[model samples]
Target: MKTRQALFLVWAACTALANHGAWAQNNPVLLADVKAPRVLMVEEATGTVLLSRKPDEPFAPGSIAKMMTVETVLDALSRSEISLDTTYPVTEFAWRTGGAPSRTTTMFAALRSNITVRDLLSGVIVQNANDGCIVLAEGLAGSEPAFVTRMNERANTLGLSGSRFGNSTGLPPAESSMTAIDMVRLARHMRTAYPQVLPLYTQADFEWNRIRQRNKNPLLGTIAGVDGFAAGFAEGAGFSLMATAMRGDTRLYLAMSGLASEKERQDEAARLLEWGFNGFTSLTVYGAGNVVGQAVVYGGAAEKVALAPREDVRVYAPTGDLGRLSAQVVYRGPIRAPINRDQEVGRIRIMIGDAVLQEAPVYTSEAVGEGGLASRAKDAVWSLLFSWL
Candidate 1:
């Protein structure tokens, strides 16, 4: 028995192998474990789940709630409701809750002083300014509760059904909750919709009221591709991070919560990102409009029709042992006659072990007409003869 098979898979004259036992072998990258309560890494390009641990489990967001706050402010800006220079007066409640005398982390805004939207954003995103978020919420929606209603609406619109927001800042009212998966979806949506705001996450520090505060995103500067995102921690939540990094056209978003310490969160995020980038390589299994296989025709003039991929089939798989990937043409058999060109008849499912990487629809390259009576009889005989082959 050939227990270990090395099958040569060809696409566009490129030889890729699928190793049957590659995953069973000892691999250190797969063994590097992350110590976090929940973690998830998704490649934005292909929407592949590179790593997931309790991605849907709800957990406290801590200060990472500011991500949504910034998003809401950006939404208002898009709607022409506010601008970068628009200034809002700080209220007594905002100052008392998240501002200067409360002992919580603040952007150090002066009481009753007016600040621009840009400055407050820097306070919220760069400084994790709790008071800054409250100020922005009030400025945008007239009250924190109203702003939070909009926040929940935004979450629902973005398909983040698992997330719930009670406050603009991810502070612990204990009711504010989000899952790792939901956070990643939120990050993906924010980056896709409002790319201009991402650079704010990279800003190292913000200075206000003669006090300079640095961005708390632990992955920034420490990791190569990591650019902007937020990190949060609370008494019960421990440490949580929502980070996104880009290497070429491929962007990876990571969301992790419930780490014992900041160092552990950073370390875990770094390891996971490294593993995602270094451990995997994108392989194109089928090119667009290229014939992958042929399907038998029952009543067509031609005995068989060519099947091609309707779109390009690309997948991210482990770097080495390319042979571990396998592809198959799957569809209901004995395709009927009078098929038109580019008609979807089947699909090419590319898989790595049991996991489906991509499924590209197979289309007919040329039309096939119905067979004449005599031809149909001959074809029936031929099909009967070759059906067992």
Candidate 2:
């Protein structure tokens, strides 16, 4: 494998935007004021992270893990393994552990009573019902432990490397943890993959067994564009929140943990959400279909193949010019011949200083077939020379 540094230029227009008086200066000071030990805020459109601190450090997710639980169920629904109308019984275990007996957040469903998947989702989303999570876990996988296995598997499939589920309900005494970055990834995936089901998070309240509870997420309705996601707390991890907000064409996902109080959690989340929306502007790094870079094609008719992003490669940059911006096209090479058009070959990583702010996949723009014996021989000689160097 070899690494090549390709040319990456920032358009003058981006610099002009940064200079414009309308935009606020990049505020590292404000970000520093955030009290959470782990925090991340990302632009949904370009996946550009506006602010991050200890994003990869794992912490007890508390009720925030419910988002993953919801994602697992949504995955099952998409696979047709279960329907919204499917029902599960609330066993004594569920009632004792998460319902009225446990004195935690719950939908208060009667023991041995069966509830529909639709209602369970409502309970989980709107009420953060632990019993609903247990019932759904048991119903879907015949036991909570079995369902937990599915949850961890789903997390892996989703590329959430910093998360693990010990139980469906995220209750204490059951080990479950997640990173700030993983929470953002999960929230983004849920919103993107399950748009139809996202409205469940906006539901203000849910009623079951004649007991009603308002949505536990504090940001909803209070923040200008806050809509869905969850808030959580653990004894050692303190408070945590995973939330998404949309204002017009832009949407942002945020995750923060290790706050001192619930008030701090809500306040820090709101502050970051506002900052994410107002503190950055979009900059197109590469237009749609524009060749971003090139990758060596081994034994191909052509020595190299052009690579481009299928969509416009964009990043949300700070309004102020506080840091140097650069990009690199990264790929393992030389890619073998017979590469098809639009085949993914590499990634474009956009960075500020040494920190990667965003990354997007790049693909071959055209097919490259195997070359003649002479071409192969020439490439082999060049490869040998480079190896010696």
Q: Which prediction has the highest TM-score against the true structure?
A: 1
Instruction: For candidate 1, write residues 1-389 as lDDT tens digits.
Output: 11121222223222344322354332435423667768888888777777778999998888888888888889889999889999998999999999978888899888899999999998888888989999999998999999999999988887888889889987766368889998998888888899788788898888999998777777778898898788888787789999999887778888888889877887888888877887777666677877777887766899888888867788776766466677777766567678899988777777767777766777899999998888677766765765564
lDDT of 2 by residue, 94-118 (tens): 9999899999999998999999999
Relative to the unseen true structure, what is the C-alpha lDDT of residue 28 in candidate 2, on a scale of 0 to 100? Answer: 47
Lowest summed lDDT over 10 consecutive residues: which window, candidate 2? Answer: 8-17
| Regions of model 1 farther than 4 Å from truth | 1-28, 248-250, 295-304, 332-338, 369-389
Error of model 1, residue 214, in angstroms: 1.3
Stretch of 10 with least lDDT, candidate 1: 1-10
- Give per-residue lDDT, candidate 1, residue 99: 90
- The lDDT values for all models are 0.80, 0.85
- Tell me the TM-score of each prediction against the true structure: 0.84, 0.81
